[model samples]
Target: MTLTLTSLGGAGTVTGSRHLLEYEGRRILIDCGLFQGYKALRQRNWAPFPIDPKSIDAIVLTHA
Candidate 1:
Protein backbone atom coordinates (compact mmCIF):
# COMPACT_ATOMS: atom_id res chain seq x y z
CA MET A 1 0.00 0.00 0.00
CA THR A 2 1.07 3.55 -0.63
CA LEU A 3 1.17 6.07 2.16
CA THR A 4 -0.40 9.41 1.56
CA LEU A 5 -0.42 12.63 3.54
CA THR A 6 -2.53 15.73 3.49
CA SER A 7 -2.53 18.87 5.57
CA LEU A 8 -5.99 19.65 6.80
CA GLY A 9 -5.12 22.64 8.96
CA GLY A 10 -2.35 24.82 10.38
CA ALA A 11 -0.79 25.30 6.98
CA GLY A 12 -2.54 28.08 5.11
CA THR A 13 -3.78 29.45 8.43
CA VAL A 14 -2.50 29.43 11.99
CA THR A 15 -5.61 28.56 13.90
CA GLY A 16 -6.90 25.00 13.85
CA SER A 17 -4.61 22.03 13.32
CA ARG A 18 -5.22 18.68 11.61
CA HIS A 19 -3.30 16.16 9.54
CA LEU A 20 -4.25 13.10 7.52
CA LEU A 21 -2.05 10.09 6.98
CA GLU A 22 -2.46 6.94 4.91
CA TYR A 23 -0.02 4.10 4.48
CA GLU A 24 0.14 0.38 3.89
CA GLY A 25 -3.60 0.09 3.40
CA ARG A 26 -4.05 1.80 6.74
CA ARG A 27 -5.21 5.30 7.52
CA ILE A 28 -4.37 7.52 10.47
CA LEU A 29 -4.93 11.03 11.70
CA ILE A 30 -2.68 13.22 13.75
CA ASP A 31 -3.19 16.30 15.87
CA CYS A 32 -6.85 17.01 15.52
CA GLY A 33 -6.32 20.24 17.41
CA LEU A 34 -8.33 23.38 17.33
CA PHE A 35 -6.74 26.64 16.39
CA GLN A 36 -7.09 29.53 18.76
CA GLY A 37 -6.73 33.32 18.47
CA TYR A 38 -8.59 33.91 15.21
CA LYS A 39 -12.11 33.34 14.04
CA ALA A 40 -11.11 32.08 10.63
CA LEU A 41 -8.77 29.58 12.15
CA ARG A 42 -11.26 28.45 14.77
CA GLN A 43 -13.86 27.90 12.09
CA ARG A 44 -11.74 25.15 10.62
CA ASN A 45 -12.87 22.79 13.35
CA TRP A 46 -16.43 23.08 12.11
CA ALA A 47 -15.37 22.02 8.64
CA PRO A 48 -15.32 18.38 7.62
CA PHE A 49 -12.11 16.44 7.68
CA PRO A 50 -10.83 15.53 4.21
CA ILE A 51 -10.91 11.85 5.08
CA ASP A 52 -13.55 9.87 6.95
CA PRO A 53 -12.82 9.31 10.61
CA LYS A 54 -14.05 5.73 10.37
CA SER A 55 -11.18 4.91 8.03
CA ILE A 56 -8.61 5.97 10.56
CA ASP A 57 -6.68 3.16 12.16
CA ALA A 58 -4.63 5.18 14.61
CA ILE A 59 -4.16 8.63 16.01
CA VAL A 60 -0.93 10.10 17.27
CA LEU A 61 -0.92 13.42 18.99
CA THR A 62 2.30 15.16 19.83
CA HIS A 63 1.50 17.52 22.65
CA ALA A 64 -2.04 17.76 21.31
Candidate 2:
Protein backbone atom coordinates (compact mmCIF):
# COMPACT_ATOMS: atom_id res chain seq x y z
CA MET A 1 0.00 0.00 0.00
CA THR A 2 1.19 3.52 -0.77
CA LEU A 3 0.57 6.53 1.52
CA THR A 4 0.09 10.09 0.26
CA LEU A 5 0.60 12.84 2.79
CA THR A 6 -0.87 16.33 2.54
CA SER A 7 -1.58 19.44 4.56
CA LEU A 8 -5.15 20.68 4.58
CA GLY A 9 -4.64 23.79 6.67
CA GLY A 10 -2.18 26.04 8.50
CA ALA A 11 0.23 26.67 5.72
CA GLY A 12 1.67 30.00 6.95
CA THR A 13 -0.51 31.08 9.84
CA VAL A 14 0.42 30.47 13.43
CA THR A 15 -1.96 29.33 16.20
CA GLY A 16 -0.06 26.05 16.28
CA SER A 17 -2.71 24.54 14.01
CA ARG A 18 -2.13 22.12 11.16
CA HIS A 19 -3.73 19.21 9.34
CA LEU A 20 -1.29 16.54 8.26
CA LEU A 21 -2.69 13.50 6.56
CA GLU A 22 -1.96 10.31 4.65
CA TYR A 23 -4.68 8.99 2.40
CA GLU A 24 -4.89 6.65 -0.53
CA GLY A 25 -6.52 3.36 0.28
CA ARG A 26 -7.71 4.79 3.57
CA ARG A 27 -8.93 8.36 4.19
CA ILE A 28 -7.56 10.15 7.22
CA LEU A 29 -7.70 13.68 8.65
CA ILE A 30 -5.17 15.17 11.02
CA ASP A 31 -5.86 18.26 13.12
CA CYS A 32 -9.25 19.63 12.21
CA GLY A 33 -9.76 22.58 14.51
CA LEU A 34 -10.58 26.29 14.89
CA PHE A 35 -8.09 29.07 15.47
CA GLN A 36 -8.54 31.84 18.00
CA GLY A 37 -9.42 35.42 16.92
CA TYR A 38 -10.62 36.50 13.47
CA LYS A 39 -14.23 35.92 12.50
CA ALA A 40 -13.22 33.88 9.47
CA LEU A 41 -11.14 31.66 11.68
CA ARG A 42 -14.03 31.11 14.07
CA GLN A 43 -16.39 30.50 11.15
CA ARG A 44 -14.29 27.57 10.05
CA ASN A 45 -15.36 25.78 13.21
CA TRP A 46 -18.96 25.66 12.01
CA ALA A 47 -18.22 25.47 8.29
CA PRO A 48 -18.39 22.14 6.57
CA PHE A 49 -15.03 20.47 6.06
CA PRO A 50 -13.65 20.10 2.54
CA ILE A 51 -13.66 16.36 3.11
CA ASP A 52 -16.57 14.60 4.78
CA PRO A 53 -16.22 14.20 8.52
CA LYS A 54 -17.39 10.60 8.24
CA SER A 55 -14.43 9.90 5.95
CA ILE A 56 -11.91 11.08 8.50
CA ASP A 57 -9.92 8.24 10.11
CA ALA A 58 -8.31 10.07 13.02
CA ILE A 59 -7.92 13.62 14.36
CA VAL A 60 -4.40 14.35 15.57
CA LEU A 61 -3.97 17.52 17.58
CA THR A 62 -0.65 19.14 18.46
CA HIS A 63 -2.17 21.54 20.97
CA ALA A 64 -5.60 22.57 22.11
Candidate 3:
Protein backbone atom coordinates (compact mmCIF):
# COMPACT_ATOMS: atom_id res chain seq x y z
CA MET A 1 0.00 0.00 0.00
CA THR A 2 1.49 3.24 -1.15
CA LEU A 3 0.03 6.57 -0.16
CA THR A 4 1.17 9.98 -1.31
CA LEU A 5 -0.04 13.46 -0.44
CA THR A 6 0.46 16.42 -2.75
CA SER A 7 -0.28 20.03 -2.08
CA LEU A 8 -1.82 21.58 -5.13
CA GLY A 9 -2.16 24.93 -3.44
CA GLY A 10 -2.10 26.78 -0.10
CA ALA A 11 1.50 26.06 0.72
CA GLY A 12 2.79 29.57 1.36
CA THR A 13 -0.30 31.72 1.02
CA VAL A 14 -3.67 31.49 2.73
CA THR A 15 -5.89 30.88 -0.29
CA GLY A 16 -6.63 28.07 -2.72
CA SER A 17 -6.25 25.23 -0.33
CA ARG A 18 -6.17 22.16 -2.54
CA HIS A 19 -4.63 18.81 -1.74
CA LEU A 20 -4.39 15.52 -3.56
CA LEU A 21 -4.21 12.21 -1.81
CA GLU A 22 -3.33 9.10 -3.73
CA TYR A 23 -3.56 5.65 -2.25
CA GLU A 24 -4.52 2.17 -3.37
CA GLY A 25 -4.84 3.34 -6.92
CA ARG A 26 -7.34 5.97 -5.92
CA ARG A 27 -7.02 9.73 -6.09
CA ILE A 28 -8.85 11.89 -3.58
CA LEU A 29 -8.96 15.64 -3.83
CA ILE A 30 -9.37 17.79 -0.73
CA ASP A 31 -10.44 21.41 -0.52
CA CYS A 32 -11.03 22.70 -3.99
CA GLY A 33 -10.65 26.41 -3.43
CA LEU A 34 -9.92 29.50 -5.48
CA PHE A 35 -6.97 31.89 -5.25
CA GLN A 36 -7.85 35.20 -3.66
CA GLY A 37 -5.41 38.05 -3.00
CA TYR A 38 -2.83 39.80 -5.14
CA LYS A 39 -3.01 39.77 -8.92
CA ALA A 40 -0.26 37.17 -9.18
CA LEU A 41 -2.01 34.82 -6.80
CA ARG A 42 -5.41 35.37 -8.35
CA GLN A 43 -3.90 34.60 -11.74
CA ARG A 44 -3.19 31.09 -10.55
CA ASN A 45 -6.90 30.45 -10.58
CA TRP A 46 -6.79 30.65 -14.34
CA ALA A 47 -4.09 28.02 -14.64
CA PRO A 48 -4.97 24.48 -15.60
CA PHE A 49 -5.22 21.77 -12.94
CA PRO A 50 -2.07 19.71 -12.39
CA ILE A 51 -3.88 16.47 -13.10
CA ASP A 52 -6.91 15.47 -15.07
CA PRO A 53 -10.09 16.21 -13.15
CA LYS A 54 -11.70 13.01 -14.45
CA SER A 55 -8.90 10.95 -12.94
CA ILE A 56 -9.90 11.85 -9.40
CA ASP A 57 -12.01 9.15 -7.74
CA ALA A 58 -13.55 11.46 -5.18
CA ILE A 59 -13.41 14.99 -3.77
CA VAL A 60 -13.50 15.80 -0.07
CA LEU A 61 -13.94 19.48 0.63
CA THR A 62 -12.73 20.55 4.08
CA HIS A 63 -14.67 23.80 4.02
CA ALA A 64 -17.36 25.67 2.16
Candidate 4:
Protein backbone atom coordinates (compact mmCIF):
# COMPACT_ATOMS: atom_id res chain seq x y z
CA MET A 1 0.00 0.00 0.00
CA THR A 2 1.28 3.41 -0.89
CA LEU A 3 0.38 6.52 1.07
CA THR A 4 0.54 9.92 -0.59
CA LEU A 5 -0.12 13.34 0.90
CA THR A 6 -1.02 16.38 -1.16
CA SER A 7 -1.51 19.91 0.06
CA LEU A 8 -4.45 21.46 -1.71
CA GLY A 9 -4.12 24.71 0.20
CA GLY A 10 -2.49 26.43 3.18
CA ALA A 11 1.13 25.72 2.30
CA GLY A 12 2.91 29.06 1.93
CA THR A 13 -0.07 31.01 3.29
CA VAL A 14 -1.66 31.04 6.72
CA THR A 15 -5.30 30.42 5.74
CA GLY A 16 -7.33 27.88 3.75
CA SER A 17 -6.11 24.71 5.36
CA ARG A 18 -6.81 21.71 3.14
CA HIS A 19 -4.82 18.52 2.72
CA LEU A 20 -5.50 15.35 0.79
CA LEU A 21 -4.34 11.89 1.85
CA GLU A 22 -4.54 8.92 -0.43
CA TYR A 23 -3.87 5.34 0.65
CA GLU A 24 -5.16 1.99 -0.50
CA GLY A 25 -7.47 3.60 -3.05
CA ARG A 26 -9.05 5.73 -0.37
CA ARG A 27 -8.93 9.51 -0.40
CA ILE A 28 -9.20 11.40 2.88
CA LEU A 29 -9.28 15.13 3.32
CA ILE A 30 -8.07 16.95 6.40
CA ASP A 31 -9.47 20.38 7.15
CA CYS A 32 -11.84 22.24 4.80
CA GLY A 33 -11.22 25.83 5.76
CA LEU A 34 -11.74 29.10 3.91
CA PHE A 35 -9.14 31.75 3.12
CA GLN A 36 -9.33 34.91 5.19
CA GLY A 37 -7.44 38.20 5.78
CA TYR A 38 -6.13 39.95 2.68
CA LYS A 39 -7.97 40.24 -0.64
CA ALA A 40 -5.56 37.93 -2.40
CA LEU A 41 -6.02 35.21 0.17
CA ARG A 42 -9.78 35.62 0.19
CA GLN A 43 -9.86 35.38 -3.59
CA ARG A 44 -8.68 31.79 -3.32
CA ASN A 45 -12.09 30.85 -1.99
CA TRP A 46 -13.54 31.51 -5.42
CA ALA A 47 -11.17 29.01 -7.04
CA PRO A 48 -12.36 25.50 -7.84
CA PHE A 49 -11.19 22.60 -5.73
CA PRO A 50 -8.17 20.76 -7.08
CA ILE A 51 -10.16 17.54 -7.08
CA ASP A 52 -13.78 16.53 -7.29
CA PRO A 53 -15.59 16.88 -4.00
CA LYS A 54 -17.47 13.62 -4.54
CA SER A 55 -14.17 11.77 -4.99
CA ILE A 56 -13.25 12.28 -1.37
CA ASP A 57 -14.02 9.23 0.78
CA ALA A 58 -13.94 11.02 4.10
CA ILE A 59 -13.23 14.35 5.75
CA VAL A 60 -11.50 14.95 9.09
CA LEU A 61 -11.97 18.39 10.51
CA THR A 62 -9.57 19.42 13.30
CA HIS A 63 -11.71 22.28 14.49
CA ALA A 64 -14.94 24.17 13.90
Candidate 1 residues lying further than 4 Å off, grouped into runs, are: none
Q: What is the full ranking by lDDT, best candidate first?
A: 3, 4, 1, 2
Instruction: Give the winner by lDDT: 2 or 4.
Output: 4
Model 4 C-alpha lDDT per residue in residues 1-64, reported as the tens digit of each score: 8999999999778789999999999999999989999998999999998899999999999999
Q: How many residue pairs clash in each candidate at the backbone level? A: 2, 0, 0, 0
- The whole-model C-alpha lDDT of candidate 2 against the native structure comes to 0.63
Model 3 RMSD, rounded to 1 decimal = 0.6
Colliding residue pairs in candidate 3? none
Considering summed lDDT, which 10 consecutive residues are worst modelled in model 3?
Answer: 9-18
Candidate 1 RMSD to the real structure: 1.7
TM-score to native of every candidate shown: 0.77, 0.61, 0.95, 0.95
For model 2, state the Cα shift of residue 25 in Å. 1.4
Error of 3 at 58 (Å): 0.4
What TM-score quantifies how close candidate 4 is to the native fold? Answer: 0.95
lDDT of 1 by residue, 1-64 (tens): 5778888778866555678887888877888878776776667677776777788899889773
Sort the candidates on TM-score, descending order.
3, 4, 1, 2
Clashes by residue pair, model 2: none
